[model samples]
Target: MPHPTPSPREIFASGPLTGHVAVPGDKSISHRALMFSALAVGESRVEGLLEGEDVLATAAALRAMGAQIERGADGIWRINGVGVGGLLQPQGALEMGNSGTSTRLLMGLVASHAITAAFTGDASLTKRPMGRVIEPLSRMGAEFTAYPGGRLPLILRGINPAVPIDYTLPVASAQVKSAVLLAGLNTPGITRVIEPIATRDHSERMLRGFGATVTVEDDAAGKIIAITGEAELRPQRIVVPGDPSSAAFLVVAATIVPGSDIVVENVGLNPTRAGIFTALRMMGADITELNPREVGGEPVADLRVRHAHLRAIEVPAELAPSMIDEYPILFVAAAFAEGRTVARGAHELRVKESDRIAAMAAALGACGVRTEEYEDGLCVQGNGGGAIAGGGTVRTHLDHRIAMSMAIAALNARASITLDDASPIATSYPVFFQSLDLLRGETLVPAA
Candidate 1:
């Protein structure tokens, strides 16, 4: 069982951080590994899976649907799957706690199986718009009874012998794309998705690895992805790489804290997910990719980061999909840079665990950093490695990234920064503060 959420208030006005740390496994990959494994007929072995609450929610949901999942003392997870079209209707609502990815992707899995499953989540997850997935999956013959705006606490009734359609994405969303693909797994004929813009390709790659016939082609309009239905997936031995998203905080902390030298090992540098590193390098941070290799068909590398005088640069709109989850921390990095950093074409940030643009703007302003928020992005003026006034308490609003980002920003602050709730950090990075202590060379003392 996971520990109770602790209301830990971190106060770090620290010096140079010097250490090498390996972050937890990729959360996206961990969820997919468990999901795909549960759809295969035989036993699948997974190592390096993130044990955070979000992935655990996916695991619990799969178990409820009759997959046999177990973890060994050796840290490897084993799953005996129920095969495609073999999911049992869960007896109770699938509780998806703060994980939108699990809820959306699992909705796709349940959308074509001739079963009815109700999905519910924590307060934060229930508020996110599920209409993006609802519209497409509903088109595939699934019936949904959702909240007024297609929010969660919804029930999905799947149809057997579902209809397959070609969908051109209205927005660049990998979750919507993945849900549609997963729904196609049990339907007959080919299910096609025409993406107007590229999102993360983890699902496509992992689906192919599980012996599904998934194809990708570039046309005049964007990439076209097609998956054959009623296909059998083979169980695989998978090793999940370290998540770069989790590594973002450590990397940025090392860069901004001055005189810091650190190596983040075995991080997934998937081209689709390495946009943060590219943006940071463009901002003149001294981050080098060391020992590039491949793990479980994804690119993996060790990142060596050292403190450098950073200059803010305009982040390309095209880079948003690649590093969509990283903007909160990127904003923190920008605050310590030499000039104004502008990020645009990231409207997706508005719909995350919180309205990230608004959350970050308000938090930075509270900490005395100059920031301008936009409908799609932010413009932040750097403090040029100077002391940041940080006596204000930032409201995290149950957002894990916001809490962790503010904690990293506090390293360079003149005063101890406080967060309204750090408990949300357990959603993805449960060992985050422990790792922070390793780098900081002291245990983080929590406020009363």
Candidate 2:
């Protein structure tokens, strides 16, 4: 696979953004749809799948493991699965690119199949901690040979007749939770995961959609999810909703850009992932949920956002799991609000593609926004709805969200904002710049 050359891109201050746009499909759902469908007995069809590099990496890995996946000219992806416990060991290493979700979730799928495989990734993905998934999967009898701290470039050998275990999640991570459930698919008995904090439930929902028996129960302790092992998955047509995480940038851009009125259509509003909208509403953003309905078992809505005077407020800690990926851009929204906005209990941001808290703090500070970084979060002082001084360039550190967030911040900037290494944006939202151009009502020619 060829990699796009990293280059600096500039986003200039624009007038009010006005348009109806749809972002790419939900990345989380896209990944699971591909994985689950690949494990089914027959051909599964998926529409509106995110064709970004991250999801493509998952598709490629599955194909390498004997799943027949193809994309038709009609824009639908069809996959012929190898069924449960039928995956063949790949001839070589699986190149996961920039997707931690792909690497972790696929590890779970590979953990009980009696196959040996090596997983490797780019510099950024190599550094992300895999131990979270490793420890739990290891308990299921899978053996791993990894770098120190459970980093990537590792080999995993699955144990036939792997033991099923009931494990409690030490952290609030959907990836870890999904990995355990996926691993349980081939075990002899039930594999249970008790999550102390609720994360995204796409895996449970989609698994059940694919004919897997997954049960979720809630108690004072938290969410208890149990999956039966050696279960057969049924293939079905899936329509993925627009990603709320990808829509966050559009929502925030519309809210902060003066006279802006835009509708983001068909966005997934699963309660687990709508915290960004809730947080923005709490900050007095004028956002309305329209045409509420369901798509592929997940709630979908068209969001209408208008320019409003935003006031900074302390974000609730419990909402962190729901909106973990939105903080970098929420920090951008906070920069345009009045007074100070405080966000905490999001130490997870520290372990994302970049140290988002530190990365956003440094980037915002460079753009003349007052921000204070903390161990868990940040306190941002708003410029009181004034134009932000954004002449400085921001280093993206190969994090897609950071690059896009800074681009949203540039809408209200006093000068053009330059971003270093915007190539990573292709990992999740390949048409992000095109969407920006549409909303801005002009072509944004990147400086060579």
Q: Write the per-residue lDDT of candidate 2 for residues 1-448, one digit (tens) a residue.
A: 3346887888888899998999999999999999999999999999999999999999999999999999999999999999999999999899999899999999999999999999999888888999999999999999999988999999999988899999999999999999999999999999999999999999999999998999999978888999999999999999999999999999999989899999999999999999999999999999999999999999999999999999999999999999999999999999999999999999999889989999999999999999988999999999878789999899898899999999999989998899988899999999999998898897776657
Q: lDDT per model, in order? A: 0.94, 0.94
Against the true structure, what is every candidate's RMSD?
1.5, 1.0
Model 2 accuracy (lDDT, Cα): 0.94
Clash totals for all candidate models: 0, 0
Model 1 clash pairs are: none
| Residue 92 error, candidate 1, Å | 0.4
Candidate 1 residues lying further than 4 Å off, grouped into runs, are: 1-6
True-vs-predicted CA distance for residue 164, candidate 1, Å: 0.9
- Where does model 2 exceed 4 Å of error? 1-3
